[model samples]
Target: HACVIQLPFNQKVRNNPDFFLRVIAENASCCYSMLKAKNPGFTLGNRGASGMFPSEAAEWLCYHAFTVKLSNHKVVYKCLLKPLKFCHWGCFKTGALAVLCHMVTVLANL
Candidate 1:
């Protein structure tokens, strides 16, 4: 509960234990990585590159916790949703991604 999630920007910037904003990256490392690709250094004022991606991350956290897929669980939702003024994005962005679609359709069709 006291751990941090480092965002792509934060990861590239070297190290800052505040990127816990990863709850927003939504396990989408690609997007997360791309979002911080432009700014390859530490964040300035708010430990973020005054841009859309960082804001997106913040916005995501306001309604979610951990970089897991969206769910109907209240506890999970609220946890992921709890907004942190700032956090690390690199942590949650590290794991592998699961296929989000239902494979049953393809299998049944086959």
Candidate 2:
């Protein structure tokens, strides 16, 4: 089973980051419960930009630990630095590079 959650713009830009994390965790838990009831052996996979982030990663880890009882699940963590084709836009290149650099720094520290 797969699902894409579209959070509201206001919620995404909320002052309290924990609020958005809580929303994601609550929704993910509900989905996991439903899917687990239907099939005990089902594997849960997370994709897209959110999958690579720390908050979502924590939520997925917790879900896997409590529900699936397994720590190994495939998560696609794509680099966000791809160029846009239609408009020839390189606008977000700097931001994407920054995020990639920051991720490398964090990983190196760990």
Candidate 3:
């Protein structure tokens, strides 16, 4: 239950006794998606470190991408992690469709 703090859970997961597990799975999937997007060459699926913290990875990846200083022949790490806002701007209409597609696929298999 230490993982998967946030996700778009179904009403079943949100209202039922299996809420925690559902959350964990959603959080795991989010982590998996982000890692896959960032490091496409890495083969990560149902396998990962025994325990992976999304917040920790989120902080690390955010810093690595947004912070750190790069200059000619020089790279420096300030090692400061900032509190981040969970905001995603721009239209995500297509993303919603992708989610719908995946949901349909899952339901079809079931």
Candidate 4:
């Protein structure tokens, strides 16, 4: 199901980068927390440390192309797309279809 939705979500982000950035910025706390938890070091601040700040993370997610591995390890960090898609799917399933539809309509109008 996630794989099915990923393509459209990726295209949406590509088509509306600014809109997706705003959406991500609105949920900055969630992004920050998740990133901090995943990378407990200076990874959030130092771009040289295979690290990415929140905005870069957002941009990477928008393009569906971020592949920063942990320092000296093979573990690839999690992408924001997974959680975002989970939340979206959950909302759509839990009586938020109208709201989502309205969002789609708004996006379409843009």
Per-residue lDDT value at 79 in model 4: 36
lDDT of 3 at 44: 37
lDDT string for model 4 (2-103, tens) is 332365534533354455445554554456567678877655542222333433333334333222221112222133445545544444444334443554
- Residues 1-110, candidate 2, lDDT per residue (tens digit)? 12112445633212443443354457655664565466656443333223233233333434333333211211311111111111112212323334435667998999
Question: Order the candidates by lDDT, highest first — what do you get?
Answer: 4, 2, 1, 3
lDDT of each: 0.35, 0.36, 0.34, 0.43
lDDT of 1 by residue, 1-110 (tens): 32223334444211432343353444444445545666667341122323323433433443334423333333433433334312333322421111111233455688
RMSD (Cα, Å) for all candidates, in order, is 14.3, 16.4, 18.6, 17.7
Candidate 4 worst ten-residue window by lDDT? 65-74
lDDT of 4 at 35: 66
**Candidate 3, TM-score vs. the true structure?**
0.25
- Residue 91 displacement in candidate 2 (angstroms): 34
lDDT per residue, candidate 3, 1-54, as tens digits? 112234345332224424433433355357657776887665433322212222
The number of the candidate with the highest TM-score is 2
- Quote each prediction's TM-score: 0.21, 0.27, 0.25, 0.24
- Report how far residue 28 has shifted in candidate 1, in Å: 6.5
Off by over 4 Å in 4: 1-21, 46-54, 62-110
